[model samples]
Every structure is written in C-alpha cells, then in structure tokens.
Target: TLRPGHAQLAQTARLADLEQRLARVEQAVGATPAKLSRLGVGDHSLLATAQHLASRAALLDSAQLDAAESRLTTLLTKLDQVAEKTAAITGSSDPDRDKKINELYELAKKTEYLSQVLPQTLERMLALQELHQQGGEFAKALSEIESVQVQLMAKMRSNGETLASVEEGLKTSFATIKSNMEALDGRVKALSTKK
Candidate 1:
C-alpha cells in the first residue's frame, strides 16, 4: 500500500519536471527566429526540446507518465495555434540546424524514456541485492553502470545548456517587444494630445 504522501511527492516531482520541460520549450520557440537564422552552437538542442514536448504529449498518460496529459495536450495545441499565426514570418534558412534539431529531439525523448525506466529497474535490483548493498563502495560501484547510461546522462545535460541559452534569448526578445510597445503607446498618447 502506497502512502498518500508518497504519491503526492511523486506527483510534485513529476510536475516540477513537466514545468521545467515546458520552460525549455518556450525558450526554444522564442529563440527560433535567431537560432534558425544563425544556426548557433546550442540551436540544435533548443529546437529539439520544443519539438519533442509538442509531439510527445500523446504518448503519455496522466497516471503513468505523471503528466496531466490533457493539460500537456492543450499546451501543445496552443503552440500549434501560435505557429499558425506566425507561420510566414519565420523560415528555416539553415537546413542543417533544422535537421540537427530533429535529431537532438529524438535523442532527448529516448533519454527521457530511459530515465523514467532506470529508476524502476534500480528499485527492483535493490531488493534483490539488499544485504550486499550495504557498503558505500559497493553502491558506488553499482552506480557506475554501462557506457550507454553515462552517455545518455551526458547528452541530457548537453541539451540543458542549449535550453538555457534559448531561454536567455527569448527573455531578451520579450524585453525588446515590451520596449517597442511602450514606445508605440507613448507616440499614440502624444498624437491624441495634439488632436
């Protein structure tokens, strides 16, 4: 029997993860204008994260995936709507960046899937190795798994920096937009006062 608090904690962790993922997507989409134009170092992972979060909502369920699937689906739908609005403003000039972004997204999705699985596997393994799992050194040795696991974790982090860069770019864009709006509004007020 699972305690209520245990389930709540899991939900909290999962929601935090989902929110973090959403933040990454917002940052990526915000940076698309520049990233697609220049094809910078972190551009691949940035765009990939956005594409994955948009596409993967269908494969998840509320109970198992720990995402409120409906909310995610709605969020993706809103992104599609936004895309429709500005579809013509942005063009993917850098085909190589676009391709790399797709590849990165696929890799990120695979890594996320594995991360969700490995913990369950580790829990089962712990039960079997309990008595022998005592030594800190033994735990450390067990922690260092195969090369594949190491690679996945590294790749995930590699993606994080890209996401962070995207976020910064987006915030800067937002500030510019706000400043432009304020300028326009001030002009409107001046014109009205003259009238």
Candidate 2:
C-alpha cells in the first residue's frame, strides 16, 4: 500500500534527522577539551601521546567509514532507481508482475535497512573526524609548548654562563687587591724595624 513518493519522503526525513544528530555530535566534540580530561587523562605528556595515537586511529577509521559510506550511497541510489521503475511498471500487465512486486518489496526492505544503518555509520564517521581534528589541535599546542620550553632553557643557560663570567672577574679583582695589600704591609714592617 505504500506509495513510492511516500517512501522517498520518509527516507528523506530520516536522513535529515540523521544530519541534525551528526551536527550535534560535531558541536559537542568541538566544545569539549581535546585533552580528554573527563576520561581521567591528567598528565600533559600522556595526553600528548594519547592524542598522537588517537590521530592515527581516527585517520584509519575515517578512511574506512568513507569507503563504507560511498558504497552505501551507491547502493541506496541504485535501489531507489529500481524501486521507482518497478513501481511504474506495476500497473502494466507484465508477465513478471508478481516477480517485480517481490523484487520491489525486497528493495524496500533493503532500503529501510540501509536507511536505519547508514545514519549510525555516518554519525560515527563524523565523530571520528571531530576526534581527529581535536588530536591535531592538541598536537599543535604541545609543539608550541615544547618550542617555548626550549627557548626558556636556552635563555637559562645563557644567564648561567653570564653569571659564571662575572664570578670569575670578581675573583681576579679580589686576588689583585689582596696581593697589593700584602706588598704594602711588608714595606711598612721594614720601615718600622728601622725606626
């Protein structure tokens, strides 16, 4: 009893709903911290390492999801076209009318299954993409932090070298002053002995 147009409309609505859900997931992922602090990841280095691992994993998952989505899309399009053609021929006295109806039924079932399952897969793909984005951002931030730390260490080393130089200069000046003082004391003692 279902019309072709009605089935298409229902599928379209389902797709729209799936899209909205994906958008929400994307927004949530963006809003959360990249460090995954909620998951008890507290250490900076650990978070950086975890993000690196996650980036690779997400990349692989996204690629797989892309392939699956593409295949599902192709299958869905073919099914839709076949369903339309089958529905068009239903009114004709074709010898394979019953067979065509059965085929149409089978297509509808497959289409419904794909409609139900594809959204979940797409949702996962979107979430993985968001995770990949976050990992990249975290890696960039860690890199910046490391650069700053290196600059700070270099500055500290320069300051230490300058302090050592100053200390050596002070030691030299003190030694010269002490030598001069001893020589003057020896001269005064010789003069006092003559007196």
Candidate 3:
C-alpha cells in the first residue's frame, strides 16, 4: 500500500541510516586496519565499497539507472570478501564475540540479498525504457514498476530495522557479559588474596 512519494521518503530515511552506520563502521574499521589486514580483509576496499554504495544510492535517487546498475554490479563482486571477513572475525573463540559475529554475518547476507534485488529492479526499469521507446502505452508499466519499487523499499526498511535490533541486542549482551566477567574476576582475586 505504499505510494511512490511514501516509498521515496522511506528510501531516503533508510539511506540516511545506512550512511550513518557506514560512517560508524568506517570509524571502527579504520581505527584498526592492521587487525583487518591480519584477518585478510582489505581495509581500503571496505571503505571504497561504502563510498561506492553511497554514490550508487545517490545515482538511484537521480534516476541514473545505468550508472547505478554498473556500480551495483561492482558492489556485488565485493560481497564475498566482506562475507569472508565476517566469517574470519566470527571464528574467534569468545562468548559475546560469536553472537556479535553472527549478527554481522546476518547483516552481510541481508546486504547480498538486497544487492540481488537491485538487478531485478534495474531490469524492470530497462523494460520500462524499452516500452517508452516503442511509443506505446507505458503508463501501466510505469505504475507496475513503481509498485515494485515501493515493495523493494519496504523490504529494505524491514531489513534495516532487523539489523538495528541485532546491533542493540549485541550491545546489551556484551554489557551483561562484561559485567559478569568483572564480578567473577573480582571474586577470584579476593579468594586468591585470602589464600
């Protein structure tokens, strides 16, 4: 039931959220390129990927489908590396680390799924272009494509919300685990001192 205007608003909001998250990620990843390098993740490439995604989002907003499609294709090629990085990070043997890594993996998979949806959206746009060139009735086609775009935007918003929830949950779990570890360490130290 999303209108085009509503869809645009939703897309814009999600893009803004994505940009903020990307910034946070860049800050984290940039702070420790050596750690990522040790894990075989090219830090430069990750930053580049984020920039490319931001540019593609801008292009999509401007209706530059061809350019956006090219960018998207390039982005898709980088997904594997990102996923591998996530897997490597998750492989560390830490209690809360596993949960956080799993969240990251889930987010990466969702990103891949979203990328796959882009090609289909681009295809529809291309089809609409062809219809327009034929000098025939393209109104219905446009409407249908717009509807598809709305649905895609809705799906993206839902995924974004899910990612946010996972991140929040991870933060809470980490706090709890850290508190318990601190208490246990204190108890052990006290007992050792008494002995």
Task: Say which candidate scores most in TM-score.
Answer: 2
Model 3 lDDT at residue 156: 98
- Evaluate residue 5 in candidate 1 and report its C-alpha lDDT on the 0 to 100 scale: 100
Off by over 4 Å in 1: 1-145
- Model 1 pairs in collision: none
Q: Residue 50's C-alpha lDDT in candidate 1?
A: 49
lDDT of 1 by residue, 126-159 (tens): 8868756567667676677656699888998999
Best by lDDT: 3
lDDT of 2 by residue, 51-138 (tens): 7678767858977889989999999999999988987876655668778888999999879878878999999999999999999999
RMSD of each: 55.7, 37.8, 55.1
Superposed model 3: Cα runs more than 4 Å off: 1-133, 137-141
Query: How high is the lDDT of residue 75 in model 3?
Result: 93
Report the lDDT of model 3 for residue 141.
81
lDDT of 3 by residue, 1-195 (tens): 999999999999999998788779867766366755654545655666556567766866755887778889989889978877977976755778778988999999879877879999999999989877765556768888999999999999999999999999999999999999999999999999999
Q: Estimate each model's TM-score.
A: 0.26, 0.38, 0.29
Model 3: colliding residue pairs: none
Ranking by lDDT: 3, 2, 1
Q: Poorest 10 consecutive residues of model 1 by lDDT?
A: 35-44
